[model samples]
Structures are given as C-alpha cells and as structure tokens.
Target: MTERSNQSVRRAFKLVDELAENGPRGVSELADQLDMPVSTVHDYLQALIATGYVTKDESAYKTTTRFLEVGHRQCHRLEVFKAVRDELETVAEETGEHATLLIEEDDQAVIVAVQEGPDAINLFAYPGARMPLHATAPGKAMLAHMPTERVTDIIDRHGLVEVTPQTVTDPDVLFDQLEDVRSQGYAIDVGERIAGMVCIAAPILDKNDRIRGAICVCGPRSRLDEDRRSEIADVAQRAANVTQVNLDYV
Candidate 1:
C-alpha cells in the first residue's frame, strides 16, 4: 500500500476506535481528539457511514451495532470459547463467585466468556474485556504454560505494570511465580489487579498439552479466605479440565 493510503487506513481505524470508546461525537470533537483536521475527520466519518460501520444522529457520529456482529462472529470462531461457554456458568454457580474464560491475544488476556453466581461480586468484567497478562490469575495461568521465549516476548512488549500494590512488577519474580503455577496446576491472584479481590485460575490444555486458554473464579477477599480459596481453586481446575476434555469431543 502507498504511504498515504496506509496513513489513511490508520486514521480511519483510529476514528472508529475513538467513537467506539467515547460514544457519539461531533466532527470537531473527533478531529480535536485525533489531532487531525476537521475535513479529514468528516471524510473518514462519511466513508465509515457508507460502509455501515458508523451512523450519524443529527450532528453527532457514532459507531453502529455492526461492530457487534463482527465481534460476535469472531468470538464464535474460537473452539475453546465454544467448549467453555457453558462450563463457566457451572463454575460460577458452584462457587458462588465470578467465573471467567480468558485467552491470550496480542499479548493481552481477553475475556471470552463470563458468568456470575447468585452471590457473585460485581467486578465490572464482561466479554471482550482486555487486561495485561501479568496482572490477573487467568492471565498468569495461561502465561505459565507458554514457552519461556513467548513469555519473555510478552513481558518485553508490555512490561509488568503494577496495577495494585500486590502486582508482581519484576520479571524474575514473575518467572518464579510462574514456576509455582506449573507445579501447582493453578495460579492465584491476591489483590493484584484490584484491591480486596482474589482469584484462582487453571490453564486448559489440548491433548498435546498445549495451552488453549484459562478458566478462573474471582471473589472478594473477605469472602475468599484461605480455605475458600483452596476450594475454589479445585473447582476452577476441574472446570478447566472438563473444558479440555470437551475440546476433544467437539
């Protein structure tokens, strides 16, 4: 592609991302935020509208639900997601906590499915939520099973940013903890990503022991004492195992 066309593509995607994140916006507002000229923003918005990816209401332009269609199609294409969809609900109901399925993409953990038990705490996590792989139990669970080179690459790309006081920000410390995860067959998060929250996760592996993704249960620390954490860990691991088995039959 020509340099001009490539720049135009990047600008167009940026405009769509801004609209998706911030909701409806006017031409001047988008131009100001993207540091582009008003006419350019207008032209991009017009092209997006023509492609049915965006819509305008009066003077404000917003992304259309067409994006949801695209995301939905992409999500279902993952075999692991389909295998674990119903199992996550079972984990949540069994543990009375939040259950989530996460897969690594672009060096980040993306939530593919989530379920809340009757007594589950609200963590504001939903499908498609992306988080650093070093900051959450499921992310760690998946990372622990990956090759050392891949893990190092991910750490190099996105440093171990401290999300909370408990987050491991040192590469050596994280590698040591990953060793524990491999031996124990599960990963733990104690107020790492968010204060007062605790999580336990297990990696799902294929027949060849390749890491597919992870399943986790999360709850408030007050509700997840040491004993309770152990119980949830067992449950999460069993859920992950079931998903792994289902992957073979499906």
Candidate 2:
C-alpha cells in the first residue's frame, strides 16, 4: 500500500482507539486527538459506522460490538491452532493436568483449546472462553512481550479487575510482573484468577517473532508449589516450543 494510504489507515485506527477509550466524541475532538482534518475524521468515522465497527451518536461516535466479532474471527484465523490442539492433548496426558491454548486478541486472551487429563478437574476454562490479558499466565506471557505503548493502552482500556486474592490489581505491580515475565520468557499464575489453581505458560512466536499464542498447563496449587514450579515451567515451555516449531515459528 502507498504511504499516504497507510497513514490514513493509521489515523482511522487511532480515532477508533480514542473513541473506544473515551466514549462518544464530536468529530472536532477526534480530529484534534488524531491531528487530522475534521472532515477526514468525519469521513473515517462515517465509514466505520457504516461497517458496524463504530456507532454514531448523532454527531458523535463510539465503537460498536462488531469489533468483538472481528477479534473472534481473527483469533480463529491464526494457523497456530493447527499446532496447538495435539500439543495440548499431549501435555494433558503427560502432566495429568489441564492444558490450554490461548491466543492474544488485541489485549485479551481467548482460549482456543482446552484438554483435560484422565483424572477429572473442574479447574480450567473451556475452549472459546475469554479472559483478561493481565490475569492469567497465558495472557501475561503474551502481554509481557507486547510493545510498551500497546501495553499501556491495554491497561488504560481495561484496568486489572481483581478476580482473586492473588490477582495484581495495581497497574504498577502488574507492569513490574510483565517486565519480569519478559526477562524470563514465560509467566506464572499462582491462583491469580481462581483459587487453588496454578498455571505456567510460555509464548508461541511466529516466523516473524510476533507472539501468536501461548501454551499453558493448569494444576492444583498443591501440585504446583515451589518444589515443582520449575519442573512445570520447563514442561510448559518445551511444549510451547514444540508447537511453535511444528508451525515453522521462529
């Protein structure tokens, strides 16, 4: 695409982001935020509204539900699932724990695969489940690698809602944890989203080094204490790497 076309698209996306975060706003406000002509912003807003990606409030505009549908469709379109399904089953078999495949959707994590071990456990989420980007291991593993501006925007859009006692509700604390996860190349969720459950997750990267998804293993907190945490991390990381390799991921 031409540079001018790319710039226009970026400006349109920026307007969408602003509308999503700040609610409905006038075309003049949008143009000010995006530093574009008022007519240009109005044109973009009208196009987005026509596509059902945005909704008009008389002269103002805001995001519509279509963005969520778009995100869901995009989540399934990623070829990462071809490698994740069988690997999750294998991980569940080997670890005797729940295994899940989570893909990053904007700033959220959606579970695309969930495999249960032979022994029953009502612990993990099912396929098609959505979770916050900062609460779960798989979610954090993906977020930890995102660009700083993107991460900040996600935090601004959705502040950490405390799901459990272990949940990091403070943005600063969560930022520190994300940095640590990036340094370690993985993330751990110790009953953060649900009590008595622990998860270990590693990022799955594509050939371009972009994180596509995460592979995670979930077990009872008793089974994943400090003694076995490292082992669990190793197993989860290896499984994730194997899936990435099968997809010719970097």
Residue lDDT tens for model 1, 1-250? 9999999999999999999889999999999999999999999999999999999999999999898888789889999998988889999999999999999999999998889999998899977889989999999999999999999999988799999999999999999999999999999999999899999999999998999999989999999998998899999889899999999987
Which residue segments of model 2 deviate by more than 4 Å? 1-76
Tens digits of lDDT, candidate 2, 1-250:
9999998788888988898768999989888877889988888988888888988878878899887787668656768987776787888887888888898876789888788887538863766677898889999999887888888898889988888989989888988998998888789998898788888898988777788889888888877778677876787888888887878841
Best by lDDT: 1
Against the reference, the lDDT scores of all candidates come to 0.93, 0.83
TM-score top scorer = 1
Give the lDDT of residue 203 in candidate 1.
98
TM-score of each: 0.97, 0.68
Judge candidate 1 at residue 101 and give its lDDT.
Answer: 91
